[model samples]
Target: MKENENKNEIVEIDDVDREIINLFNEDGRMSYRKIAKLLNVSIGTVHNRMEKLTKNGVIQKFTPVIDHSKLGYNLTTIIGVRVKGGVLENWEDRTAYHKNVLCMYDVTGEFDAILVARFKDTSELDQFIKSLLREPDVQRTYTQTVLNIVKEDLSSSKML
Candidate 1:
């Protein structure tokens, strides 16, 4: 059994569940009938397993991996933030909801949090960073613009 930190409960995924998850990770558009045929199980079985996995919160949502650069969000930058201690969570909750923020992480070392965000250009990024710094809880920030993305794989099952 594995603990779900968000739910604060025990959740166990069996071998079949792992296999189904791997298949979905490979191709989110894979149908239950195809999965059943591949696994030599009934379509009903595949459906039930997937339903269970979703209900148990193992599967959050099925979404596509998009290329942000192609969508005119060409500026990808990593912003490291230093926040006032004891208010790290509060500050993270505030910064994470910005539309340009693609991902945020509570990290270690010199920064308390890291934000991966996308913008159309440098001016937009500058405005966003300035707004973040204006927050009383935010102490400082270091921004590094991405020159090029060599590899970006959001799905974790490619190794499987």
Candidate 2:
């Protein structure tokens, strides 16, 4: 059983559930029939398990793994930001909806939050950093450009 942090619910996942998840992680478009065949189970079992997994919040949503560079988002950056006292959440809420922000975290260190964002070019990145600086609560920001991506997999199913 795994605990869902968001819902505070215990999700019971058996070996079959793990296998189904692994197959979907490899290919999200895989059909229930195919998964059933591969796992040597009935198609109904696959459907029921998927439904239970989704209902339990074990499977959030199926999405494609995109290569941002192929889509002209040529620059990837990791930025650490320091916010004014008591306004970290406010700043996070304001910034979370930005199209360029891929992921954000409330972290422990010198910085209050960290953001991973992608930009089309340096000009866009410059504009974004300047915009953050313009915010009253944003005390400072440190940006680092990524030169190469060794590996990027945003799937937890691999760990299972």
How far does residue 89 in candidate 2 sit from its true spot (Å)? 1.2
**Span of 10 residues, lowest total lDDT, candidate 1:** 1-10
User: Each model's C-alpha lDDT?
Assistant: 0.89, 0.93
lDDT of 1 by residue, 1-160 (tens): 5545558666787777888999988899999999888988899989999999888887889999888889899999999999999999888777789999999998889999999999999999999999988999999999999998998887786443
* Per-model TM against the reference: 0.86, 0.93
Clashing pairs in model 1, backbone N/Cα/C closer than 3 A:
none
lDDT value, residue 81 of candidate 1: 94
Top-TM-score structure, candidate number: 2
- What is residue 1's positional error in candidate 1, in angstroms? 16
Give lDDT tens digits, candidate 2, residues 43-159: 999999999999788898988898888999999999999999998998899999899999999999999999999999999999999999999999999999999988888785776
